[model samples]
Target: MKFSPLETPLRTIMTPGPVEVDPRVLRAMCTPILGQFDPAFTTIMNEVMEMLRQLFRTSNRWAYPVDGTSRAGIEALLCSIIEQGDKVLIPIYGRFGYLLTEICERYGAQVYTIECEWGNVFAPEEVIDEMKRVQPKIVAIVHGETSTGCMQPLEEIGRACREMDILLVVDAVATIGGTEVNADEWHFDGVIGGTQKCISVPSGMALITYNDRIEKVVLSRKKVERGIQTDSDRSILAAGKTIISNYFDLSQLQDYWGPRRLNHHTEATSMVYALREGLRIILEEGLTERFDRHRLHERALIAGIEAMGLSLFGEKKWKLPTVTCVNIPDGVDGESVRHMLLHEFGIEIASSFGPLHGKIWRIGTMGYSCRKENILKVLTSLEAVLVYHGVHVNKGEGVQEALKVYIEQSKAIGAGR
Candidate 1:
């Protein structure tokens, strides 16, 4: 087959990330390109920062994008704040916990980790106990661990960090738009999130923030070379210990986005437009409503899956609203079912990593793809595929169970309770 113009099947993206992009975001990106420093473009950039502040529930002036993926934002925060031999405490609950430890070690931070089972989250007392013991300079954690479909509760942990004066950093990629991340209320020194997850934008950009506590550390560790320092140049460069990775340096990135507009790598114009529009759509929906939507769809999806006689894989209370992990019933080929869903139904679902692989299916009700129809479609297709594979399932039960949840919810709303 000759490779002509690129064309692919339209898939219902119900996987962990890179969900179906909002058509409005796509339309926003289609506008003509502008120079990175153009006044109008810079205005949009400013608006994005302010909007991200609202999304993060932060008043921190440093809130902005990392110009890369979610991990990039994590690295930016870690690299800028963590010095050689600075002790960093990380609690391992899932894959992203491992990622936090890996990144901190790479930056020469003395990494101390407390781990829990993959599907389980640490209690506030547990994390606080570790903090009291280690008294590390920073505590890094993942708010939502998509790999295990778990969300770690951070309210108490954040309060502990504030009282102890330990900087609290969170990777909120999986929870930012679809769930609550009270940066200010929770005393988050830094927060990182990807555009692709609940924000409904294409993968490529990251939204992140740093508070004054972290800003103090970053400025103290600053390393800069002044060529023509202006009154507007608030850049903290290579004056002290320089950040290892220049590309991921928060100082330079901050300077560029700051009053000075110091030259850095050219921003990805289209992604900025997409992110702006994505944030706009999220704000329009209202954060509480969007979070409730994710929760409602997740509940409905789980109801449908359970009605089909499949069990969930994790602790019930900690399940992430954006991702659901369904156990593969005995004698069922999890991969085969996923393949059928992809090839036959044109629906994408994810399998787990490491020990959980093949034991569970990770389904996402996130971003633009999280809808009543999408949930019904996948649950129905899954039942069909399961029954066809010789697993016993009642016909039409998945859709029926899911619709029941919607009806109950609507009636409750109607009753104004």
Candidate 2:
């Protein structure tokens, strides 16, 4: 086969994450590259940090992007804080929770888990009860479970953990820019996010924030290894054992971001540019306004899906606005319908993992892809695919219902004045 310019299909990405990137961010990445330590590049980095602070709604000076994907930031937090045999309690509701357990175990942390149904979130009381029972040093939870499209209530859980003096860590990769998450107000020790989900950027950088309390814990436990030399002036003491992994070490990374400006690995230049521009868009729109857009689009999508006689997989009250899980109709092949939508209609949705693999489809309305036009287009195409698969969906009902929602919302806004 001969390729001209490596053309790809124009897709409306409705998957859980890596939603469509804004064209402005895309264009920003095309600018000429600069050296990692260049003064101009460092200025750009500072600007990115300020934008992230505004987006996360936190005033901590430790806010910055990790050099890898979302999971890298998760690893950085766990590997730095979790010493061998330390107790960690993880409340597992979806696939990412399982990932947390696995990463913790890799660093020799003793992992305990409380399991919930795939489509549900853990109640605050349940989490508190588990904390009392386990008395672990750390409690890890996912604010938004992409696999199930459920949003866990963080305010209560965070408070309970703080009262007990347990460190709280949250995976907010799917929730960060799309929902209302105040890192400081909720008192999270550490929160991790990514550029893909709500920031509408390519997936390369991960963002993590740690409060002073968590930073103190990290500093107190530092120990110098047998062979490694410690700089007398450095604030972070090296662990006696070799740092869990060279690339993921937070001690060196902290120094790099600190006033010391120590050299570490070279940061990804293009990704930094994209992340900076992506966060600029978020701050310009204002975090609250962006969140409202996501919520409205989610409600409209739900209305349309329900009008087509489909049931949502998760509870209505706890569902994440960024991603929606819908049960597959009986007698319809879920994978077949997804393939048809992608190959024929240039749309991409996702199938769930683990227990929900064949049972549901995930439709995402996040970042730049969360728009009225995209929502209507996906609903119309999905209706066609369902009908083609011999599922009993009312013809043209999805789009019509979505339009009705838009009209109702317009009237409500008009009446508010």
**Candidate lDDT values, in order:** 0.90, 0.88
Instruction: Give the Å shift of residue 147 in candidate 2.
Output: 0.6
TM-score of each model, paired residue for residue: 0.95, 0.94
Task: List, residue by residue over 121-198, the lDDT tens digit for candidate 1.
Answer: 999999999999999999999999999999999999999999999999999999999988999998899999889989
- The local distance difference test score of model 1 is 0.90
lDDT of 2 by residue, 237-274 (tens): 33323346868777778777666778988889899899
Instruction: Provide the lowest-lDDT 10-residue window in model 2.
Output: 233-242
Model 1 spans with C-alpha error above 4 angstroms: 223-240
Instruction: Estimate the Cα RMSD of every predicted model relative to the unseen true structure.
Output: 3.5, 2.8
In model 2, what is the error at residue 51, expressed in angstroms? 1.3
